[model samples]
Target: MKKDIHIPVVEDVYIAIVNEYNAIYKTQDWNAYIINNKAVDLELVLIVTSGYSKKKATSVFRKKLDKLPKQSYAKIELMQEELFALNNTFKVTFFEGNQMFDKTYLFRENTINLKALQSIPLMAVKGVLAK
Candidate 1:
């Protein structure tokens, strides 16, 4: 039975942390975003995020979308500078037609920094991508 079971691979989807200027706060802030680079739309998208260290952990956050169009992106949450010290995780699950896909993206402690910024797909700004 195990050999007959099939788990679809999740591809062309990413969780990125972008450093953007907050117009209201008048300071630089880090924001989490979900990028869907696949050609087909994603349905019933669900994401859970959290940060943790050996001694402490942040609260788990949940977000959902009814549908995410292809080659588009959406903001997931705002990340505080303090969270950078912990291991951040984003767990994503979504359906494409009748198939369901799941993936977990992680940013190791202190990995989300200016020096790691790169040109993120499906977005105009430079950001750090979760692996």
Candidate 2:
């Protein structure tokens, strides 16, 4: 990974969004997952911990920002480091509301699904969770 890629360890991430999340990352966190956004096709992915639902995560982040962002926000990106690493491969759901129009995708080793990604508008990727 490149030094300026923004993939800081979880602790460094805490320092950035702590006050807003009661020091919890799941509520608000993220950094570039690849050495360069282009490395992952400029896709800013986050590895996240399980247990919390997307709705809960979105609500907390909105409350912290003091306003709701119309488009999805890349909140709570999972940490990738010795102390806090997430799954190397995972899936994300894309949609325009009541409909889950497409199938899930699998991502691994900094590689993502271009086909599935193309289906999602960049603005709608926020609050997405990978499992």
Quantify all predictions' global Cα lDDT against the true fold.
0.96, 0.25
Candidate 2 lDDT for residue 117:
30
What ranges in model 2 sit over 4 Å off? Answer: 1-70, 83-87, 102-107, 110-131
| Model 2: per-residue Cα lDDT over 1-131, one tens digit each | 58665432211111111112226535633332211111112122323222223232221111122222232333334432221222232222222233322222222222222222321223323222232
- Against the hidden reference, what TM-scores do the models get? 0.97, 0.24
Among these predictions, the greatest TM-score belongs to 1
Highest lDDT: which candidate? 1
Q: Every model's Cα RMSD, please?
A: 0.8, 16.6
